[model samples]
Target: MEKYTPLRTATLKPKSIYYPLHIRKLIKHKKKLFKEFKNSNFGLDEYIKVSKTIKHLINSYKSQKIKSIVSNTNRIYKYMKNISQKYSPIPCLENDNIFIFDDKTKCNLFASVFARSFSNLPTFDPPELTPCKFMHALDDIEFNLLDIDNILKNLPNNNCCAEDGISYTLLKACHSSITPFLSDIFRLSLDTGIIPQSRKVSYITPVFKKGDKNNAENYRPISITSTICRVLERIILNSLLIHLEENNIISQNQFGFLKKRSTTTQLIFTFSHWYKAVLESKNIDCAYIDLKHAFDSVPVRFLLYKLFNIGIRGKLLNWISSFLTDRTAKVKINNTFSNSFQIHSGVPKDPYWDPSYF
Candidate 1:
């Protein structure tokens, strides 16, 4: 089979893959006209016309190409990278009546602001939960080769390195070779309820939010952890989800995080309910409340307690608790690296291609 198969090598294009011959010709013509008649109005006007036409054509082509490649992961990733916001170096940050000019100092300032936002105080008293009885015993979590393979294959192909200096693209390339080793490591971690210190280390990026850029409070932390850790977490998530679905722990009314359910589905369900009420001549009342710093403010102890009450007991619960605790992150502002600091609470808010996390 190897002898009979023909090998095809991909070649990089000098121009955009979406650019056509006519567009290239028009661009060349525009450049030529600009160089030949730098001081002439007619030449300038002709160049401007050609430039506008080229722009329109390029945008139209790109739009159509995007629609065609919507389901193509590689193409979609490229387009996303092209359209993503360019990184602007953060200037001096103002904190507590002082201006921080050093990159490391700026990072520490942002980190401190984020850490201070995480509170141990409970917003409201949560009812104590009793251990849930399940039909089948789920005492521990485990990952098989198939589970690891699937998770690795589904990972984003981004080359952004985590704190461990491993990129998702490299991980995907080595998945077939490393699946067995990963399966063993994940199983051992689950059984011992201990996570590696390296996996727990995260690089937190201070992304600018809408406000004065100098204020440390105007930025949010985006944590990027080890690629291997993410894979293991996916396996754990699968196990927890299976137990949740099988025991019917998740309510039907709750649409977030469930398969085939999204904000769009939630809106549809809500609007349908409202429409039915309108038909019956009933008034509809709706109130939308946004929780400030929801993810960052969640108390770790309370979260673990809630999970334990919901049947995530034994080693799995312990593993999750360990996963959350003792984690440390360093602020990454451009080329500057901050000193490592302990993360006291909240889940890591990693950026994803989907709208799930802002």
Candidate 2:
């Protein structure tokens, strides 16, 4: 992919992957020098040059592994995920009221806690919401074989597999055979408004955050849903987004997930807006609302009502409702697994495209 974005200014960084790997080579080489050479060893200087070359080689490997886009970026994500799991775990806390240590117990404890924390019932009636007046309903959409092929082509390889034990790499390799089946599946989902059973199951892995490890709240749940489900969702999400944009449903000031928008873009916009307004002799009030755990806090039922209230109608609404409901998760701790439980509220954010439900 082209590096179209402007380059970021350089900052201080580690010399290399030396803190963990190359330094060992240095020490090992020093030991070899003492044993193999007499006083005033000439090989030490040559070894230093070799060590510097090795450091650059290691840095090059790391740089290629951690590129900012998909495909390459997943390498770094997987590497860090593995390291983080080993470094920080949600072990059963001592004397914190819970007593568990084995993988099964730990998995169960994590699941139960995250479920309760994220799927809380609404305390009050939600505010009324409606679609933009300019919005037009998207009628029954059909996915052709080409569309399905494109979806498969775009899926990143080596991703965490879903319950079906299928990775994108496998799917991409066999897309010719799978295309016909997946196309039909996508069409049937559109026609009947139900996702495949395989798509609904998620494998939840708990990643440690901070605070008490015994308390499940200290860890974040990173779910892996069916790879194919993600592709299906991507198709739907794109259409919905086009409808929203054409109708001007999304506000200009909303920059959280929009394309070409980031923390830096938001910051620049804010300062630029205020400066421009000051020169124009206009006063403006700035207010910020930080919705904690916003994605998990969404009320699916109310959101569905609003979707239908807006121009969203017909099987499309039903399809979205199906996407939002009947999802289940099972927690995995090491080799042990827990019984699957229904996800009562909020969106399923395991799959990359799943978060676009909001």
Candidate 3:
């Protein structure tokens, strides 16, 4: 009997091996043709035909893995939906009072209060203090007072005027300005003609010096942005409450007072307490309407009306209008200055001195 060798070791293999050999020969023949065509001056039409054939062959050989994945995914989703229907959660009709919700999950409007009570909060760095630090400190202390004076000075003859104390006067002026607007919305006498007392009844005198590290007692304190934020928040909340009461959403009995605190922590804690009280008492449907560009998009006519309702008149209104008309923003480093265009919408992260101006 003749010894038989494996097909791989045989000089001449079976048709199965010859099949692959034939395929390789065909591939080599095509490559040779392509090389010849490249070497010769083939017309654009011939070149295109060859390219299309190559692309077609390559595409035909490519795996359909993506298609398979997509099909599997569709099947999985269908199965999941069936399972979900069998174990679906009960629909909740009563909304959560603590969190405001819109068409999407997020609320459209919310108020923030600014107050920094603790002396240990980080101080403004050297660059920030390089400007008139003394003036800045003084200005911060006198913000509410200054705003009241301005409102009084701009009061229209038709509107009520502030009488004596800064807070008292501003409250009166604010009520006069805001009442008509509220009345228009509610078709009632929404104007209280009184300002709510400042939640912050006292101010902690700010420490000025950049204290030395060695003198542990003398180190400067952190500038509390929270304090100012809280103040603005209180103003917003009070205004809203007054409007709501006028609209009959709440009654005088439902109304409550919140004492103002000088420190950031106190302000936050008090606000949290007030928040809990409101949540417990009422079925509040809070809506936070965030306009695309609040400051920039504020139409001149509409803003004027709002200002007028707040008792702003004549030159002050004109001044505000003019100030907003041609807006320009810039940042300076060392001595060089570069100007930039200001956006019309979106809330700024850090609270500026007059955020309304933005």
Candidate 4:
């Protein structure tokens, strides 16, 4: 058998498991007291009063300690110098919409860097759904079939059935027609403005000085949470347009107009109206899925397909792919050593500009 020897100077300490013996004993005593109190013929009012008193005492002690700590560290002068130095230079713009930073002729140099980074993301793609396959799935779930005749009848009076019909020809030729079914669903929502009420409030406007540019330093920066919500609104509108266009539900010209019309403000107002109706109905079992890190993990192939579907053709696609190659950045611990770092870059989150391009 091998002999075990302890080290003269210990390099590693054994992990210690601590048992809260005192706390356990106190808890046991409290349980015994509670049992005794329950067994006794003590008045309910007295028991309630005693419980309230104990809670109040504990809370008062905690509040006193917290206040003391807060008072000791609340020196305003120490933070003044730091705050004064942290002020950002005010931004100004010149004629021709060019930004001039710090009175220099150069535009905000960081803007270009940020734009290049944004443009280098993998092209976007919507998931494909064949009309027949979609219909079959819906049928399996017993979804209500939309009124196609009513939809066709509501088409603009000036719509040329012969010429405009070609837009939907590709969809008709497909082995499974998914776009028409999607179009029906879209039309139903458009007519009713069906907004799900469960979506959490993602943004709020920050209070800032009205038209007083000098007081910029006094206001908190615009909330990033609000910006993200606006982006989500844009993404939804863009997705709807993309779905319509891909399914041949609308002409390219019609798609362009719809894209321009769908705005974040409009969507929010529409959703607000929808939720009001939902509340009136008193139905409350709705749920919302908060997708974390949605953009970074978007498959490259899916993005390529979306681009292709939206008519991002030929050289544009190739150029975008090439741009993404060198645009990535790496985090390094040692500035000189390239190997001692991990590489990463910001992937395109659902952009606020999504509706405009779609």
* Candidate topping TM-score: 1
Which lDDT values do the candidates have, in the order given? 0.77, 0.74, 0.34, 0.36
- Please give each candidate's TM-score: 0.77, 0.73, 0.21, 0.26
Per-residue lDDT tens digits for candidate 2, residues 1-358, read 1377575656544333334466567657756775555566567776667667667766776676566434665666766775454334556654366577788777777778778745866877768665358636875677878988887877676646778878889888888889999888788878988877778888898887778767777778888788887778777777877787888877788776777776778899999989999999999898878866767767888778777665788998888888878888999876578887778677777443545555
- The TM-score ranking, best first, is 1, 2, 4, 3
After superposition on all C-alphas, the RMSD of every candidate to the true structure, in Å, is 7.6, 9.7, 32.1, 28.7
Query: lDDT by residue for model 1 over 212-240, one digit each (tens)?
Result: 98887888778788888878777677677
Q: After superposition, how far is residue 258 of candidate 1 from its true place, in Å?
A: 1.5
Measured with C-alpha atoms, the lDDT of residue 347 in candidate 1 is: 72
User: Worst lDDT window (10 residues) for model 4?
Assistant: 133-142
**Which residue window of length 10 is worst by lDDT in model 2?**
11-20
True lDDT of residue 65, candidate 3: 31
Report the lDDT tens digits of candidate 4 across residue range 1-358.
1268554643543333232565345445555666767898555565565566555655665466456556544544433343344434444534345444442222223223223333433454455743221111100011122433233333232211111122222323331344356445444433343422221111111233346433322222121112212222332444444554565555433322354444555566657867997989855464547643333334445554555554444443443333223322211111111111111223222234322333
CA lDDT, candidate 4, residue 46: 55
> Over 4 Å off in model 3, which ranges?
1-301, 333-335, 339-358
What are the runs in model 1 whose C-alpha is more than 4 Å off?
1-60, 66-81, 119-126, 130-133, 350-358
Clashing pairs in 4: 125-306, 131-177, 131-178, 132-177
By TM-score, the better pick of 2 and 3 is: 2
| Model 1 score (lDDT) | 0.77
- Model 1 residue 293 CA deviation in Å: 1.2
